[model samples]
Each structure stands twice: as structure tokens, then as C-alpha cells.
Target: MTCARIPTKYGDFQLCYYTNTLDKKEHLAFYMGDVSEADDVLVRIHSECFTGDVLGSRRCDCGEQLDRSLQMIANQGAGVLVYLRQEGRGIGLLQKLRAYNLQDQGHDTVDANLLLGHGADERSYSLAARILEDIGVKSVLLMTNNPLKISALEAEGIKVNKRVPLEAPVNSDNESYLLTKVQRMDHLLQFAPPSKPIKQRAL
Candidate 1:
């Protein structure tokens, strides 16, 4: 459970960087604040998104979620953000871009992934759980909108004390994508009632 210190431009953080021998790929756990002392720590298990997180692409809410989690933790003055290096839902950047192309052709996010021969959600949370245990966080208030993340963490014995929903502003371009998440992915999005049907005038 011991971790090594890692120096970064953002700030120096204690990290347990290693490859899951099961997957045999690189992953990281970033420790912040007095995680061992706090009763319920703040945590964010974030997936890597190059286009949306770094490039400000509006295709998805990944970057905004990352920013929001950082601000919330900064305000709380405690927490950890486990930045899992699973780019493009673990299929990597090139495939994600190809999925984007499929999206442009009218495929929803899930469909795009399927079209590109990838699972709808290739990300996992086992590493996050291991990292949390290593850092001595007994329980946490997880910052996320995805219920699956909450479930995954809890399933792995990372006590999730609460679920903090990260709701981003919906725009025309990403509306369908969000809707697909709600309907297909079991995301906890509150759907507004349908508006009354418009009265049509005879032509």
C-alpha cells in the first residue's frame, strides 16, 4: 500500500503509479489532503479525455467534471482525484476520434463505441479502490454523475458515503448524447416532462 512521491507542474503529489498486472497497463493514484485523518474524504475517479478535458471539446462532460471536482476539493481543502489513464474509454485516442466521426454520422456515444468495436464504457474503478485503500480513506463522498462509478467503488470495498452529482449544462450538440446516457446507461439524469403538443394551423 506504500506509494512514492511524484513531482508535477500542477503540484507535488504522492502517487502509487503501477500497472495492473491483470491488464498490464499504466495507472496512477494521486493523493491530496489529510486523507487518513478525515472521516469521509472527497474523491473523484476520473477517466482521461484528451479532446474534451484538454481541448475543451463539448462532445462530453469529462473536462467540466474534472474542473468541478478540483474546485470542490480545493474548497473543501481535502480530497483525492484518481486520474486513471484510460483514454477514450480505454480504447485510446485514435479510436475515440474515430468514434467521434461515427457520432457526426448520427451515432450516439454508445453507438459510436459499438461501431468502432469498443464497449460502451471501457473504464473501470478497481485501481481507484486500491489507491483509496492505500491512502487510508475509509469512506468518501464521491464526486460524479455516473451511478456505475458509485456502484463500482462500493463493490470494491471503497466505502462511498455519498454521491455528488456533477451535472453539466446541456447544449444542442450533446443533448442526444446525454439522453442516451440517461436512457441506456442508467445515468441518474432527471428528465423534464414533455412540453404540451403545439397546435398546428391548417396550411
Candidate 2:
């Protein structure tokens, strides 16, 4: 509905606020440089993660991915980050927190959601595609590990030129979570051997 210029450490961007009839939620488009008709525009379709993105929770890599995507877009000087409001993979915050408790009880991310009677990933890409089209993005070099995102966007008629991997740091807390993404979701990722924990010296 409105566009505003936002200056960040990485670069200045024009943030466009969008209100779509699909979900009628406030989605956003943060773009740097001219993307109105640019080919091979870099794009990242990010779902909202309140805990990870805001509080920097270590249980997942969502915060890192969000920051890394912004940095990458800044470096390119011409990219778009479609911030979708699909919190907790679209199960909403309440269900997500409950699922986290389930995770602590020894369930993987997917299974936790399934236990909550929700799909593994309830997030949709149609809103993201519409936002991209509204922003006039022609084709994109999508930064993601999820092949399903690429397919979903394409299915929604967004031209994906190539896949640009946006991997994040693996930590003790999120190790198994990332593994489930690879093993179950078919995300294109390879895990490095976990770093050994440092032992503290006796005082």
C-alpha cells in the first residue's frame, strides 16, 4: 500500500508494504536498486520466526537466515527479500511454541508439527509470488535450500533463474532440526561434522 526508504548497515532499501486479498495480511517487500524489470534479481522468500528472528533464539537458524539473506541482498545491490507473515511455518505462534515443547521431548521438527495435528509446513508461497510480481521482479536467483520453495514459486508463475544456496551456521542446538530438513523435506544441504565442545578448565 505504501513504500518507504529504509537505510540499513548493509545498504539503503525501499520497503514496500503490501496488503493482499489472499490472506489479507501485511506482507512486505524489501528491495534495493532497480528491480522493476531486472532479470536474475536475487530473492529470498522468508517466513516469519518470532523467536528466532526477533529474540535470536538458538533453537533454530531462522534468525541467521534472515540476517544472512539481507546481507547477501545488500552485497548484490539489487535484490528483493519478500517477508512473508507465515509464522511457525504457518501454524501460528501458539502452535509453534507448543511444538517446541514437543521437540524438547525428543521429536523432530516435522513430527512435532504432525503431533500438533498440523502439516509439517503449512506456509504457502502464493503470497510471496504475488508480492514479487507486484514489485515487478522479472526473474530471480532464489537464495534457499528448499527445492519446494523454488517449485512453489514457479508454480505460482515466478520465474526462477537459478538456486543460490543460503546456508547458515550449524550449532549444537539446531543440529538435528537442520538434519530433519535434509532427510525429510528434501532440502539441498550437506552437514559438516559437528565441532567438538570445548571443555572448561577447573578453577
Instruction: Give the candidate number with the greatest lDDT.
Output: 2
Collision pairs in model 1: none
Model 2 lDDT, full chain set: 0.90
lDDT scores for all predictions?
Answer: 0.78, 0.90
Candidate 1 residue 162 Cα shift, in angstroms, is 0.7
* Model 1: lDDT of residue 39: 68
Residue 67, model 1: lDDT of 78
Q: 97, model 2: CA deviation in Å?
A: 0.1
Could you give candidate 1's per-residue lDDT for residues 1-203 as a string of tens digits? 35787654445557767666667666776666688856688898988888878998888878888877777776776788888888987889999999889988888888899988899999888887887787788899988878889988889998888988877777666666767787778887554422422122111
Q: In model 1, what is the error at residue 67, expressed in angstroms?
A: 0.5
- Measured by TM-score, the strongest candidate is 2
